[model samples]
Target: MRLDKFLKVSRIIKRRALAKEVADQGRILINDRVAKSSTDVRVNDKIEIKFGNKTLIVRVERLMDTTKRDDAELMYSIIEEKYERDFKNE
Candidate 1:
């Protein structure tokens, strides 16, 4: 699945267009490398998203063309969530 579609289907970003915009702005990383909206997403791939001061890291657990809201969270396993400002205090 495409990165944008995966993000939308998985409910990570809530919308495909926003996901594409985010990816185009270089706010997304796959396996530690920058990724575009059309990037292929496969199982076990690590996805890191930068949201302002917050960073979300998740591993793709599965992929489906469409899923219900209740099942969306099953697609990815959140590995870490960190806030840049929080870490700055350390």
Candidate 2:
């Protein structure tokens, strides 16, 4: 699945366009490397997203063309979440 599409389908970003914009701006990483909107996403891939003052890390657990709201959270597993305070310490 495409990174942007996966993010939207999984409800991680809510919209595909916004996800594409974020990826284009280099705000997302896959397996510790910068990822583009068209980047391929696969199971077990690590995805890190920088959202303003917060950072989120998740591992792709599954991929589906479409999923219900209740099933979206199952697509990825949260690995770590860092806030502004965490960044200040690093």
**Best candidate, lDDT-wise?**
2
All candidates' TM-scores?
A: 0.93, 0.93
- Candidate 2, superposed: residue stretches over 4 Å from native: 86-90
Candidate 2, residue 25: lDDT: 100
Query: Roughly what TM-score does model 1 have, to 2 decimal places?
Result: 0.93
Cα lDDT tens digits, model 2, 1-90, are 999999999999999999999999999999999999999999999999999989999999999999999999999999999987655568
Relative to the true structure, how large is the alpha-carbon lDDT of every model? 0.97, 0.98
Clashing pairs in 2: none
Query: lDDT value for candidate 2?
Result: 0.98
